[model samples]
Target: MAPYASDDSTTGGEVDEQRSGRRKAARYVVPVTVMGVAAATIGLVPALADSGDPDLPKITAQQLIEKIATSDVQQLSGTVKISTDLGLPDLGGLESSLMSGAAGRGEGGSSADPTAKLTELASGTHTLRVAADGPDKQKLSLLENAAEYSLVHNGKDVWGYDSKSNEVFHGTASESPKHEKGKEQQPPATPKDFAEEALKAADDTTSVTVDGTAQVAGRDAYKLLIKPKQSGTTVGAITVAVDSETGMPLKFTLTPASGGAAVVDAGFTQVSFAKPAASTFDFTPPKGAKVTEEKDAGKGAEKGFGKGFHKGFDKGEARKHAPKSEEGLGKGLGGMKTIGEGWNSIATFDTGGEGVPSGKGGGDLGGFVDSLGDKVTGKFGSGTVFSTRLVNALITDDGKVYVGMVTKDALVKAADAGK
Candidate 1:
């Protein structure tokens, strides 16, 4: 099936399906590319497993933090395994919409996109190896069903290929390497960020410390741990595995205060700090593979992708305005206010009515959050609590919504104040 078949008569179902596919693909680049770009500055050291247990260099928490901030070992190749246990509901339908494209959505919808399948494996201990020669050249391959879903970006071209479907999407972009020495970056807060974030703490509200050395992917790593000292926070602690040699982040984990286990755990399962073969950076799609040229994709890289119907959403911007009225929430749950601070911060948005709008229910009961979370009501009245590894949200039956990285107690208090 063709990947992009533009049609003006598209139904809402087809739109949702296409949108779901785009959202899934966009999420892949955020975490993976964010991690790679940091290390790709020096070399790509994906991960190393069960390596020589060399003793980590003796350094104070402050000194270790400094080294992690300055070191750059960008040119390397290794496999990274990303795993998540966010407790999200099964997103099979969402995945189907993505994989089957317009055809799965409604009648006359004919596009078939492999991007849906890409995200389906992004979670759940999925592993892929990365190789880069310089800032302008990088290649990543995701393994699925033993078939390969690969993305190769040389200085000239960026290619996305799905072996299972024998489809290739190619686009050209002028790759420019950012060369800013000692410039700190905070993707998701690396080891050095522990110290940096601590510097902003208000009166012992946050603590940063290195919890000795351990082996990650067989390489020596210092565990930089951050904890919230405030009683209002529901955070357990954030632990980061910093490679001793390259100062690159190898793994990151976040545990909830109500945790029995980690809610968010992402890291490299294997890695190597060695230059990959030159041939590894080269790519040629299998013969007879249907190729789509993106020369007329658009003026910008994103515009090009959009022309091919691979639209991307701005996750960061979306988060800032999530509770707003994009979902026809005109008079309810539009503006969310912040309360507390740091790991203890809570966001509360009031529906300003009796309950959630359920079309015919008229906010009597049930929820708009049901599609987003599990139904759980308590002293704050009936509501649904949508939770992930890091964030938990509570939507009350009284048109009140509370969310935070803090505890359920903090959420409840925020809900009470909204009343």
Candidate 2:
């Protein structure tokens, strides 16, 4: 967990046992939003296990960085899948409530099932078609039920199509069409997507290294691992599989210090570096489909790309600024206050005000989040602890949400001190 670190080392690295004995910890945020914390159908391509190739050159951490820093893969196509295991209960409503929590932040309207984009991300297997022709054209399709949930980008025009509902959402984002410096140009995958996002701000809190080689998506690749030096975080390490020849990330995963399974495991099960076909990036929502034109809220908007609240964990601290609060800590979305800094930092929010999401129990953290994680109480004053690989939030009966990448005890300490 990047922001919320739970020191499972205290348990001698046995989170599975605690999970069996206690309330299971559900994943927070859209399954695919932060990292590849969601599942996908059979991978698009079969992964060719690494062939014994002793000649694979050994590259140093610095060499790997240089390769990644200079890599520019302009055209490619692949199958990207995200899988997660937070040991959470099956509360189908967790996604909806998290969306409602966003509405509580005063961002905008949540008319759409706000959770629609993440529907495939919540649990079961979801397969996506990813292709990129250039900076101007990109396409991603999540295939389901004879229909496809797709996002197509051509030039500045973007289209979101839900084949199941025969609905196509259109919008435009205005910006100077310019390539970013040293930005990896591969088709988007959450593991690589969020890794790039987290890497930009990782100077003080992280250590980057090059692990040995591994086969991914039938390609020869080098492994790069990123570990947070902050002892307060639950994140043990983050590993990215980088294409050896092209320096593109072929896979990515976020593992917790708890010794449980991977929390966010996402990568291209099958991939091709070949240039995508022109039609692959084109989309004409089937005739008779509902065509809704929307203002370009942004690329990562509610119904646009990733999960709803993912904006908070996004780069540039957009989630933090979106809910600017007028009251003190834990007052509202805007009232989110931080305790400490770096990886150990704890962000507290008041979910009691109007708009903040609360469950049927009204003001009860567990009720509001509705089965997103294990139900734990005690020094924290009775509530639920929402655990994701990167961050964990303790929603107390007191109407406050304490979140960080630290152990449960750390959250309790923060709660008591704030009180």
Using lDDT as the measure, the top candidate is: 2
**Root-mean-square deviation of candidate 1:** 20.6
lDDT of 2 at 307: 26
Candidate 2, 1-419: lDDT as tens digits:
33534643223347756773453344343444535422222232233233543246889877887777677777888888877555545555655455444433332232232223543354445577888876777787777778777777677666777766767776653432443322323344445565565455356677888788888887888888888787767777778888899887777877888877776677888888798889887776678776665543333344323222243233211222112221212332466678866556778877673343445444576354555556776755776676654557777766787877777777878888887
What is the C-alpha local distance difference test score of each model?
Answer: 0.54, 0.61
Q: Compute each candidate's TM-score over C-alphas.
A: 0.60, 0.70
Q: Which stretches of candidate 2 lie over 4 Å from their true place?
A: 1-50, 93-115, 122-124, 175-187, 198-204, 295-337, 359-384, 388-390, 396-398, 417-419
What tens-digit string does per-residue lDDT give for candidate 1 at 1-419? 34544542233587887986786688898999978887775463433433444576666767766776576655667676655555555565553343333112221221113233333442355666666555556676777676887766665566767787787767664422233222221211122323333334423566778887777777778887777787766567777788887887677776767776765465666777687787876778789887755443323222122111122111211121122212212222347566766666666666675333332234322333356566765566766676665567777766676766655656777766666
